[model samples]
Target: MSAPDPLHDLGVRADADGGLLRLWSEHATAVELVVFAADDLDWAIDRVAAERDEHGVWRARSARLVPGAHYGVRVDGPAGPAHAFNPVHTLLDPYATGLARADDGSWRGVALAPLDAPADRVYEAAARPPAPRIPLDRTVVYEAHVRGFSRRNPAVPAELRGTYAGLAHDASIEHLTRLGVTTVELLPVHAFVSEERLVRQGRPNYWGYNTLAFFAPHAPYATTDAQAAGPAAVRDEFAAMVDGLHRAGLEVVLDVVYNHTAEEGRHGPTFSFRGIDNAGYYRHGVDGEYFDTTGCGNTLDFGGEPARRLVLDSMRYWAGEVGVDGFRLDLAATLGRDEDGGFDAEHPLLRAMLDDPVIGATKLIAEPWDVGPGGWQTGNFPAGFTEWNDRYRDRMRDFWLSDLRRERETGSAGSGIGRFATRLAGSANTFAQERGPLASLNFITAHDGFTLADLTAYDVKHNEGNGEDNRDGTDANRSYNHGVEGRTDDPEILAARRRSIRNLLGTLLLSAGVPMLTAGDEVGRSQAGNNNAYCHDSELTWLDWSWGEDARRLLATARHLIRLRAENPALRPVRYGVFGETTPSATQMDWYNADGATMTIDDWNSPAERTLQYLAASTPETEGPNRILLVVHAHEAPTEVVLPAHDGVDRYVLLWDSAAESPDADDAPGAPASETRPAESRPGERVGVAAQSMRLYRAEGAR
Candidate 1:
């Protein structure tokens, strides 16, 4: 038996003699660097045994360790599940800047870590594309999966389909630009490994929240040629993609999952973090067992310096090297946990990110909770950080799904318009005034749950496609199908579905806080009622770009709504302050209902009342005082609500109507709805909104 090497002790040096790359396998008695020929697929021309340093790091300096060379590490040591020290197995190099895939569907480490693949190849650092960095106040995030986004685009090149290049193509860029989203927050792009269990079941981990290497972009997304060229090529392709997207004027934000690793349970793979320093990297029980904070098997001990550094370094790498504009930290509360294994709002990692100059301007959004104690941190994050407002999701769901359903079934709408109004005004009670309304990243549908279509098409989740029966996802989903579940050719039901979707999208775009629209929602993408379609890497989950008339209408409506939000700064108020013009604006909101009267507390509690009206007047504050009136009626029977003319405002104009096939041009700022005063609710003209619809009117001559 030979002595083990201190893996971390070895140092890498680059000079005229090619470049030196090393992996420290402290417990491994022997380490071999397997270098593959750059032009050949099936051969490695060189094998050099790595010498060990006192700290147990394996080191080797050779002309063969050049930048373009592909390589892997084979380590021999005490064998274990958490520590698979195999001598014969060619392991992917942890520090390999480039990687490739073998015939066996496994990643092959690239020895030459740069795209050019030469000893003298100058390594260019990753850079941010020249995209506009939209302010937090104006951001409307579109959460999308990279592959799914491009897979169905016919305009994209066949060879580039489902690749980073495809996403960067003019077709994809044009779609986004037309959609009017300033930022595209992609699902995890970091390197991820499919769960062995799922692989055996013939499904891949498509959502990619399960990260294998935080520093590496997922290789599968690169072009086939790039993948063949190895990790460096893959990286270059990704960088080029971001640069292309930036040039198109859209910012790229990442959905980063740092709370846990792909190293699942205690029997997971020996990836970099686990093998490098198990005890120092992961949170453990009293007897040195794993503590699962993320419910993803093992949690990173962010309290430990090594684990903290890993996260911080990864963030810096993506922001600085990868040119990402911002990050939405998955289970962010876990990163703020203290040494005692409890969450701390002032954790060093949080403080450091807040203070880091390079990443300071980048948007920092928190998922805000974990599976650990006190995990639901909602508004608990420090100021300057925005959080995904789950409360907003629930309330909106209630308004359009539950409350709407309750209104139809029981002939009454429970809950006050005030609650919905609060969320619309950015939930002042939940988020602080200093943090402003933008602190709430309001969303109705996300990657984890039902699509906007399914939210109104299915009452319960159908996750059978996930291969987990139906028990895997959240059962407390607050969704509602107007009359029938799943798909139906019934015209009436179909019309209702469209109306519900319009309602949800309208609320999301018009809400006071920042809005995040899940991709495919605007295009009527459905997962066949499967809310948890995380594993289906097929068309069932991808956006069907082949335009249907209804889908096109929805897309157009969404675009107009987004443009409205961008043009009307008053819609995105930073704060709902005192009812005046200076400093604190966005406070001039008036509430009314059918019969044209201010809503009283009794009106809110009355279930019989299913109609309401709202007029938002933005004062001449930093944002604005643009005024618009919205009327909503959720009734099975057609009812006309009297138009409430404001005190100093006369002649209401029509700007938009959900029931209309398209937005009325007269619905623009100058040309409002009808000025006929809604005909005084004449003989059943109660301001007739169909069974379920919303209408908006812009009025002039403010009081």
Candidate 2:
């Protein structure tokens, strides 16, 4: 077998006696470990020359390099087309667990003391009460920014607001639990800094995608006390937060950025990777120009051994040492690119991640695309990975929003219920048979796009506040403002908008794939029509807990929809069904038109025919047999639909109405039990459906 990998343990490690520093550089002629004075970071107290081993790893040791010592590495290497090496440049360790900004505006690594107990024991103790390990079919993910999530919550302490502790506060947990989401997917928490361009423009990179350090918790996100107490304290606070969330039965998922670093283009700052070994760390063209895949200026060379080791190590640290239950990989397509810059389904790094015992147990999600050539790889990831389904988001938006706009302006919807129906049943055409519907992560809105309320209130993006002259966000919003754009006092317009919210929410929760809800969508939050609000950190991005009557109604409707999804097995399927055969955990679907007969090919593809009755019966392996009937009418005008008659069904009970202001008049708990009047209806009976509405009914078989 080949020699063991020397890149392992490639950062500062403290022990009872002293500390050891390991740096990896294939081309370095000389590497030195420079120790700085704690009082004056710019003053180097001592420098020890590191010896290079056969495996290209430079190693050094010192008693002065003990815990809390500030240090950096200086490497001298031959300069060439693919390299940008400077002997005097002090580079931060790539695997630095703690970092400190020096007085000269540079960075230094801080050696952290050994924990009171073993790292695994500490993490396990902190993660007491444990994650509920909610099944993928039963999981509902709520994506939120850690700072924006509890920043404005009046119940959270003022000092703790906008911090990790704030998110673990009782008020925040209560809101999430009451909303019925099982997991909270947080935006990037890796230590990041504002981009050079944004810093020059007096703005900040609010989304935290520009990762500066992979193994460190962002110090600024902690309370002032924690920040002042240093990196160890910051880490403790983060651990406490995870423990609190786990105790409350809510899982935490982190949005991880590994495709690119904070270091931008060729002329960008030489902080860590660039100063150490540019050629070995980053992707570059033969002519020495950076191959910027991901559109973030520089892409990490995943094909390189050292780079792959770094990513795998960081993931292991986060999953085992920190208590996160899952990860959402940003710009994941870049991670699968080979040395030739071509996409590979079984890339070494990707396979390593799936096979690694430590990282493989946790949930893995991929954004599945980047800005590079041939970057859209949706439904093309490995078996255990779930990918964000942009197709689902687009088609749902088109059917409900853009189609409505076309119907009013051109007297045609421009599409039919066929495409929408396929998506509702989990986009079988998109994902593979073995992977099934769970491979598709469905969402109508996310942190990078327009809120659900804005989708029904704005036809075009109003991004003037983004300082790009309304050109910063995507123009293909697929949104409609009913009859008017922006805010309007017209009661009819307001009513239609509210109904649209209910319809979209219902579609997301009742679909066959995993649903991800943007944090504030349940309360009808809007970004003032700004589809891209990545730069804003003020009240514009925070979740406003205070709500009006309409918003409250929307929140109530969301809770009811989630409950319905939990109670109905026909809505969430683990596998696709085969015709004339039963499959465990699969849904057998039937389609019909307004006349109650089996749907014709014309009904599926005709744009003018936008109404359909969907009947689904679940062949559950563990749960009870269940069935549901969904009536969809997307036309601008009302339609009368005749319920379809099936052999085993006798009555249809009304479960939910998207057209109603509330789920039920009295809002009684548990499946609208009292509203069973329209509940008991014989097949072939005609029901009046409002314009652009969805009606759900529970089918009761003969008993």
Candidate 3:
């Protein structure tokens, strides 16, 4: 009745007797399966002609398609501008679960036995731990890389460092669990290759944004044992990493690049999709020139059935078979673009992905923008998706860094606290009401930008090592140097920078939306002012675990702040409160000025009024009823402020303060961060808040 779905069973399906390989190609005249000898990859052992079925899907069967068989396809078609068929250039299967490079630098697909088995059997409940299934509100995402996370760590064994297995090591688990983050968001683990330009310059794509295959785990991330054992073993190692994190009550979210492949521009190499059906798989112009939108070459034509199905199928395999908890779609705006290359919130592919049964349960984070025309769809994604809120990032940075720099030069902060207050309360203007605050994945620093320490130490990007004549990387750093660029020995400047770092960290964790911390920010990791270090695989990008007392203090402060957020449900509201109606899981907010009076228009908009107190009380649903008070002073001058007097609130107990150098000495992992004894005060009592500092308190209820 329905012309049997053409993309179904589109990859190798094997058994003991033989195997069947099916591939979809609209323009190809013939398809031949080429099986190579296991010992010698260049030696072809069997060649079978494939039969083209009615739906344009070509099918071929052979006993050689069994597990561990090295194979490829040679497609032949008439020469045309819209066609690129080379029967001699054996192309990889678009749905390959494993890949291997040949002697001549060409690519071939490898058949793995586990791929044909039932998904449940491959990842049994006992062998593979269950997903943490952490709710959006409780999620604290620590964005780290597989290699950079453990490469320089002394705790990890020498041989296992920089491998997937290393991330599952006891040391790694202890570090993550102690940090209080619920999720570990990793950089792309999908199989990728360096860009053609980076390759020529003898540099590596350390960030792994350039993907070659969506289904295959990047084999290089596996330890020597896994790699030597073969592709299936490599995947099992990845699974073990996930299992370890899950056992520690941590979830894993992968950064996926389905927007573009490693195949660069029109003149680039003929890899899997480009060689299979160039015009059908990628967006192209009239004369076959690629419609490059992802900036790293051609964009996948998500409008087409086969191309869309490719991404969906890959996601299903990873989520169901591999047991990954979630995915963060890199440059995801391209996925929402239609046939005409226009971004649509209601794109068929986007809707389908949100509704898919397997992946729907998993967290789907969208980078939410691309380098294409009309590609900045930050707040316009579908309801089910959570987006990287760039507005929130820029606003927070401007308030804490750029605006501070402006104040020092112009004697006045350029903007008021209105915007900053909005972001701190959950960016209701950016995301929809139905989606609530959880729709925004808030982060000031990501893998693509400068490290947290660099933001306080560097005034501009230092990317001279990238071989792009320093022309690469973004120029809008929104960073401050505190009277010195790079590192400084000035005690005053150093103290100021440390306080600023704490302020940024405090704002990020205490903010209403879900927070994502870059890997080594807790220990004050710096990149030597290099804002974009994507091309560097050296120690420059690897996180150095060796740090002195300052870093240790910073880590303690981060842990304390994270614990406070976990205990105070008012700080992590799931919904926005209505005017008078109390919404469950929402926070009822009250704003006050320096005089402890209700905030008026002038107090909210005037740059001169830099101090304000925020009182948030949770309309409890899952957690207990909670209330907290947060005082913020933006100017670099000590000020005395009266605490707000609210109904049911009698006194305030201090939780954390950015004014302090760091957390107390005993505020370590097992330490109780009790009120610094003398810090508690009654409502309406004036308290001294240090310059450019913030204070958090638990509002002790009288009722």
Candidate 4:
């Protein structure tokens, strides 16, 4: 047929005797393979010339390319506006399965030992737990930083603290299992380096978005013993960590930054991608200037075949080799940009991500936007991918925090209850009917924003420590400090803040979509209003193990909410219900005003209409028939709501109450499986709903 694809078997294909190294650099004229001395990376042991094929792939065979060998490639090419091939600068293989840093801080491709597939599948209780392929509809993501998660936890061993092993420790696993989260979405674990600006400022890139190498696990995240043992050992430790999480039935989802590399802006550094093929790897104008949609300086040109393949290969490796269950593509809009420099839902790389069997079979989630034009693609991603619902986040924050503040200032909130109700019922107007509610990965707080507690205590971002003088984070933070800024001794103020947090959490779990909880939010963790705490790897970012009475109550509330979500099928719908036709696996919704009557247009739009009731009954496909009635009150004043009357429904059992201090409160429901039962209510029952709070009830009946 046609010429064989040179991209096939890229990276090192090694065995004991020797191996072949294939690298793609379209602009390079001469590519040379340099093998460094195993003991001393500075010393070169072998230099071999590579021959380029028609596809611009340079190939070289070396016995030195076996397991544990250290090597770098030196490329020389024509000096042009688009080309920056440096013969002196040693560049890492784009397809490197591993990476290592030299004493002088230069990086080389690590030739890690091949993993044993047979051994990996053997699950002798805890040896290598199989991946828990939980369905997307049932997935509950708990986003956490690998290092920060257990760094400050006293229960984790000192030696293992802040490492991948630390996150996989038994104590760490127990905490997640107890909290009832199904998936652990860790921040970028990809081998990353500090941005040149942060490095100069003597701060670290704590979030790991500045990816150095996509395929290699961050060596620093491995234990000291694993780090010294080299990249292969680091990978083993990472795999073990995944296995441990799997043992606890927790899926590991990595926040992967494939949109850009650690090689920042034009003046930044020449580590790997730049030295080899700057013109080809990065998106550039006709004059060779970079187009940075990622906000990370150099955006990896997924428009190119080689660059697109790079991402596919990385996914295959991480999913197939290291055992990651899913990936939350960071600034994913960059990945969808085509050769024409416009984002397309069906962009080749994006399509390949879902079409490729190895990656497509696993869960795929997208952050869905970047800093590029038309970048706010909130619900624009394809059906198979779940997008981080920023709209949901903003609306929830606004309804509870900002709207309440507006009510206090002008006696009227800017918005009515209509939009909030839409978000709470999974934003059918935002996501497509085919994708349904699950496509909306709803969250009130993520790693990038203020914690749940901070959202109610800070009116403005306090990010002076980020070195940008409070100019780094988003100013459009829909947050409100109640009566006073920061912490206060006012019990009423504190009580109000706690009630708001509970309301936000209740809305998130009872909503008709997959929910992602920021790791420390359940326990009211605060960064003291530092919304952009991306630089400091200190106590401000870590998940603290210790908690006071308030934090413990919040934790119990979160657990109960999660348990309620798992038990009630109506709360999480797989399909958006059609008005008249009953869609299988969908939720039939009925909206009611505070008077228990069908909500009129005025009732939905009026600023005074702060009270609404949502009744969702699931048209079950796999699960048994289920229905939930949620009462929402956003006004500062306490109000009474009449429970909506439904046909053949006897009474509603109070499953949860935001006004209740904790889930164990007499009126509120605890876990579904718990022996303690909740209070019951009849149709048209007038219930007292607290200021800015919600009450969830199970509609018990056989219609």
How do all models score by TM-score? 0.87, 0.96, 0.97, 0.97
Instruction: Write down the lDDT of every candidate, Cα atoms only.
Output: 0.76, 0.88, 0.88, 0.88
Q: List the residue pairs that clash in candidate 3.
A: none
Clashes of 1: 32
lDDT of 2 at 69: 89
Q: Tens digits of per-residue lDDT for model 4 on 39-141? A: 8998998888999998889999898888778999999998877778779888888777788777988888987755662333322223466788998778899
Runs in model 1 deviating more than 4 A are 1-63, 71-96, 101-129, 579-581, 584-587, 605-610, 619-624, 645-648, 664-688
lDDT, model 1, position 3? 69
- Model 2: worst 10 consecutive residues (lDDT sum): 118-127
**Candidate 3 on 551-604: residue-level lDDT in tens?**
988998998899988989999998888888879899999999988999999888
Window of ten residues with lowest summed lDDT in model 3 = 667-676
- Total residue pair clashes for candidate 2: 1
Q: Supply candidate 1's per-residue lDDT for 589.
A: 74
Give the per-residue lDDT digits (tens) of candidate 2, residues 636-664. 89999999999799988888888888875
* Model 1 C-alpha lDDT per residue in residues 310-361, reported as the tens digit of each score: 6676777677766888999999999999999888888998988989886777
